[model samples]
Target: MARIRIAVTGTDGQVARSLVERSAMTACDVICIGRPMLDLSRPTTIESALASIAADVVVSAAAYTDVNKAETEGALADLVNGRAPGLLAAHAYARGIPLIQLSTDYVFDGSKSTPYTEDDPIAPINAYGRSKAAGERAVAAAHPHHVILRTSWIYSPFNRNFVRTMLALARKQDEVRVVADQIGNPTAAADIADGILEVARNLIEGRNEERAGIFHMAAAGTTSWAEFASAIFSASAERGGPTARVAPIASAEYQTPARRPANSRLDCARLSRVHGVSLLHWHSSLGPCVGRILEQGT
Candidate 1:
């Protein structure tokens, strides 16, 4: 009879925007709330802001996402990434609905040689990672019906992600230098949104009670940042859009305030095995997104 209602936090972020767009194909409503209505930056306002919302599940897709900036703005990052999620979980617990908290792969220290599993130990090496790790704890503590998804290298046609950045740079520069040492899945926001919706569907329908914990939900394949950039340009070139040569470089050459993991690739087998949801390969998902970005000329 009635379609399910999936309430998501944040409005403009890549994941949030993609979730709204992706929901059109499903028989559920994705209601996105952010800013003045759900000021995650100010954790004190989230309770009052989200008081009137009604939904089958709550998705905490909002957070302090500036990794490099987070080094100096640790307190602000903690407030938005840590305390805000706990408050969201508290609301979800109060409402008796499932809470889907969007987490990051940066939670791991990236020292492990293989792709990380859900059970792997969390040892965040940066302020942003620590803040997200804190949020995971807070969410787990506050809500029993919660799914913490750890994904990586998110890109989309809708936002200021790596995909868009690469395309924009190709217009001005002939060659772009990207790190080749750091490895992870180059996940599409739309793919992530689809996976999230499926998880929400399972949670709302009460199909799998056991799928109530952390899960890695990245796209299937893995590659270095430089390789990912090459894929972007290859697809862009095929579409007659902007294309550039990706100059592979070491992580040390392009140092930033945040020290990212050497290997952040997530093992998404748990999500596939438990919820039966597997996202498309990173390159497969990138083609259409590149097409869309070319069409819009953004």
Candidate 2:
């Protein structure tokens, strides 16, 4: 088979970097465009870059990810996360290719106790979530050939994520205070990358219209942030790395500019049933990543 060309936004993001790495192991080519060449904040750049790239599929992985700062920088977040995706979808539609937009679980208000499904109504409590919700709408409106995959609690060895932060803090301190109230799947970026590839391939090769829709794809299981930290430390300890005692705290105690969902757990059944993809359990993916960070110090 001919190598599939996957055009992605952003170069340094965990998902984009992981996609490039994962594509190397497959018959797919990742063309990552970002920053000076293709900034999400700049609409003209997104258009020009997508127009020029002869890709089989496009993945919009970059976004204004600072949850707290987004409360203050709502305008920038709106432009990057809200309006940019429509342009990506419109361009990809013009070329008759599928566009995949990476979204978040923050779109929900966290009122429901169970895992969120694709049909859940969005009532974002924060600026970042609102912006991402807008992007999802724009992508859906702009093109029929779009897949909005909402993921949660992304971590990897490549970028500054929860796992790396926890490990680094363990190096400096004995006990770590983490919020235990907010629960979600601690998805590995590597797993998200692989899932993205599978979904893109289904759309690209099979032209599977069933795959072009919103889907939740997260790590198999769920845990509170504090518990996730404890699990990470446990994995680190096995590798003779930095270990820490996790002090579980409430969301009220550890406040942030953005109010996170109490329950960010996503039901990924549709992603599996439609695209034939499912991520490993949180701990299963997390252990290897923790081991890598501990060993390589990435």
Candidate 3:
């Protein structure tokens, strides 16, 4: 049997990088492309990038992910986050390849008392969320074999994510005030990439096309932003890293250009049941990430 060919966009982003690495390690032919070479700013580049890739599956990890900045840069965000995936969907659909696009949990307004389901009504509270929501709609309308995964509180060992930021701050400051009110699970980027590959395997192996849709792919439990910070600092401490006290504060205490969903918790039940993929608990996934960062001397 021939090996599967997987093409992943946004090759430089943490999520995309992890997926590419995993794909390579698993013996899959992975074509990972990034900006300038595969510029998402130019909408036509999406199709052009995938044209000669000879891929059986396409994972779109590219996006304008600067959330706070998106408030002032709405048009650019729309171009990259909204329109690009739609174009990719068109190309993937034409090639009969499954398109797996990463999304965010910001699509919800945070009013839901529990984690959000796939069918939950989308009401983005900020420009970033709006752009992502638009991207989801575009992919859904343009392609039949597509999976839009909405993940939140994403942190990885390699990226400029919350974990990294907390560790840096803990070293520099005596105390860091983190938002205690905002709640969501901290998803490991590696776990998310693995989950995506699992889904892609099913899709490429003659699995049902009906499996395509929006799915929440976060870890199993939920915690507030403050609690999450504590977890990061605790892990860092255990790893002989910084261990500054993380002070709890309300979201209002920290001001930014855009508003954040108070509760970014996503209901991943549909993802687990439909794909039959179980992700590790948030804490369980933390140590290895920390270990990797330490090994790399980050």
Candidate 4:
């Protein structure tokens, strides 16, 4: 049996790297591409990059992820996050392969008190959210075999995510202020990588044909930024890493150019029911992630 070649974008990003790391245990040949080879901002280079790799599957994980900066760089964000995934999906569709694209929960306005389902109407309140929402629409329009997995508050043992940022701040300061009002699940990159691979495996094995569409894939539970920070500190303290007191503050107190959804929780029932995939609880996933981060001392 030949190994399934998986071409992934954003070689340097957390989720992409996690996929590469986990590929060792699977029969998938994960090839990660970034920058000059597969620049999202340079759409013309995408087709050639895909042709050069000739992968059995493509995972579109690269994006302009700077939420606050997206406000000032709307055009670039749109180019990278909005238009690029669609073009990549089109290329994969032409090759008769599936394209798994990573999306975000920011597509919602955060007004709903409960978890947002796959059927929820998108109404992004920020530039970053708008860009991601556009990408989702474009990919759906361009490819029939596309999986847009909407996740939130992604962190990992690698990369500059909230966990690392909090640890760094904890080492430098006595107390770190975090927003208590903005709530969402803090999903681990490794869990997301596993979810992506599960979907890819199903597609490869000619299973779950009806599950080719959008779904919510996230951690099992939700928490505010402040509580998440506290959890990180608690975990770090237990592991003898940098720990600090988290001062909870309202969202308005810590203003940003981009308006984050007050509630970014997502319902993963469709993913579990359709794909038979579900992630660990946020706290359960965070402990190991923080331990790895501390072990690396990055």
Candidate 5:
């Protein structure tokens, strides 16, 4: 049997880094292209990159992830997050390859009491969310063989994420205030990448298309920003890294340029049924990620 060839975009980002590291364990050949190599700003580059590679599957992990900054740079965010992945989907359609695109929980306004499912209506409150929503629609229109995985509050040891931010503050400050109103799952990049690979493998083998669409892939448990920060601190403390107090605050206390949803929780039931994959609870994934941050002195 020939090993599956998978081409991944956004090699420089956290999710891409995790995919590269994890793909080595599988019987798959991973081809990773970074920002300059396949810049999202140049949508044509997405098609060019796909045409240049001979892969059974294409995974687009690259995105404009800065939510607050997206308000000021909406056009740039839309270009990278919306248009680029659309081009990749089109290219994949032309080549008869499966494209797996990463999306976000920000696509929904967080008005739903329960976790948002794949069929939930999208009404993004922020620029970044809107851009990702656009990307989701574009990919669906361009490619029939595609998986749009909507995840939330992703963190990894490799990049600048919430876990790192909390650890850094705990080291420097005695007490840190985190918003408790915004609720969502704290997904690990490694875990999310694993789910992506599962979906990709199924698609490549013609088993997952019946379940393909917008599936929410997040850690099982829901948590607020304050609770998540507390988990990070608790994990760090267990590793003897930092000892600091965490204070809970309302979202109104912290002012940011972009408006965030009070409830950003996602439902992964469809993801589980379709992909036959389960995510570790946020607390379990936090320890290793926080430990890495402590080891790296970040």
Candidate 6:
């Protein structure tokens, strides 16, 4: 059997890096494209990049992820996060290939007390969320075989994320302040990459064709920024890494240019029912990722 070629975007991003790393363990050939080759800001490069790569599936993992910065740079964010995936979906549709487009929990207003389901209404409060929501609609409109996997609080050892930020801050300061009101699952990028590979395999095998739509993929548990920080510190302390006292503060106290969802928890029951893929608990998944970061001093 021939290995499936999986072309992914955002070569420098955490999720993309995870996808590349995990692909080595499977029979899939993961090709990562970014920057000059496939710049989201320049949509013209998208088709050319896809045309050059002979991929069985396309994973649109790249996005302008600066939540606070998006408030002022809405145009660039919309181009990269909102419009680029749609362009990629169109190309994928032309090639009769599956396009797995990553989305965000920010699409919701986080007003619901319970975890967000795939069928929940979307009311994005920030520019970044609005852009992601736009991307979701565009991809769905462009291709029928598209999967918009909405995830939250993505972290990894390979790139800049909450885990790395917390650890870096811990090294410089004895105390760190984090927002307590906001809550979400602190997902590992490697876990998300694993889920994506499962979906890619199913797509390549022509299974679960009816499951081509939106689904939530996230860690099994939830926590606030402060709690998450404390957990990171706890894991770090266990490994003789930098540990700091986490001070919990309300969101109002720590103001940002963009508003974050108070509760970004997503319900992954649909993903389990449709794809039979379940991620590890956030706490359990954090350990290895933290350990790797500490060991690498990254």
lDDT, residue 249, model 5: 92
Per-model C-alpha lDDT, please? 0.91, 0.92, 0.86, 0.92, 0.86, 0.93
Residues 1-298 of candidate 5: C-alpha lDDT, one tens digit per residue:
5788888887768888888888889877778976666888986677677778898998888888888999999999999988888888898889998888989999999888888888889999999999999999899999986788888898998777888888778878999999999999999999987887787778877865596787889998999998888878778888999967889999899999999988898888888887898899988888988887888974
- Runs in model 6 deviating more than 4 A are none
Give lDDT tens digits, candidate 3, residues 230-266: 8877777788877778789988999999999998888
Write model 6 residue lDDT over 1-298, tens digit each, in one string.
6899999998889999999999998999999989899999999999999999999999999999999999999999999999989999999899998999999999999999999999999999999999999999999999987889999999999767999999999989999989999999999999999999998988888854687999999999899999999999999999999999989999999989999989899999999988889999999999899999999874
Q: Which is superior by TM-score, 1 or 6?
A: 6
In terms of lDDT, the best-performing candidate is 6
* lDDT winner, 3 or 6: 6
Instruction: List candidate 3 segments past 4 Å from native.
Output: 296-298
Q: Could you give the candidate ranking by lDDT, starting with the highest?
A: 6, 4, 2, 1, 5, 3
**What digit string (tens of lDDT, one per residue) describes model 2 on residues 11-74?**
9999999999888989899999888989888898887888778989899999999999999999
TM-score of each: 0.98, 0.98, 0.96, 0.98, 0.97, 0.98
Q: lDDT tens string, model 1, 194-291?
A: 99989988897785459899999999999998999998999999999999998999999998999999999999999998899999999899999999
Against the true structure, candidate 6 reaches a TM-score of 0.98
**Ten-residue segment with the worst summed lDDT in candidate 1?**
43-52
Error of 6 at 211 (Å): 1.8
Q: Which pairs of residues have clashing backbones in candidate 5?
A: none
Quote the positional error of residue 131 for candidate 4 in Å: 0.5
Q: What residue runs in model 1 are displaced by over 4 Å at the alpha carbon?
A: none
Clashes of 6: 0
TM-score of 3: 0.96
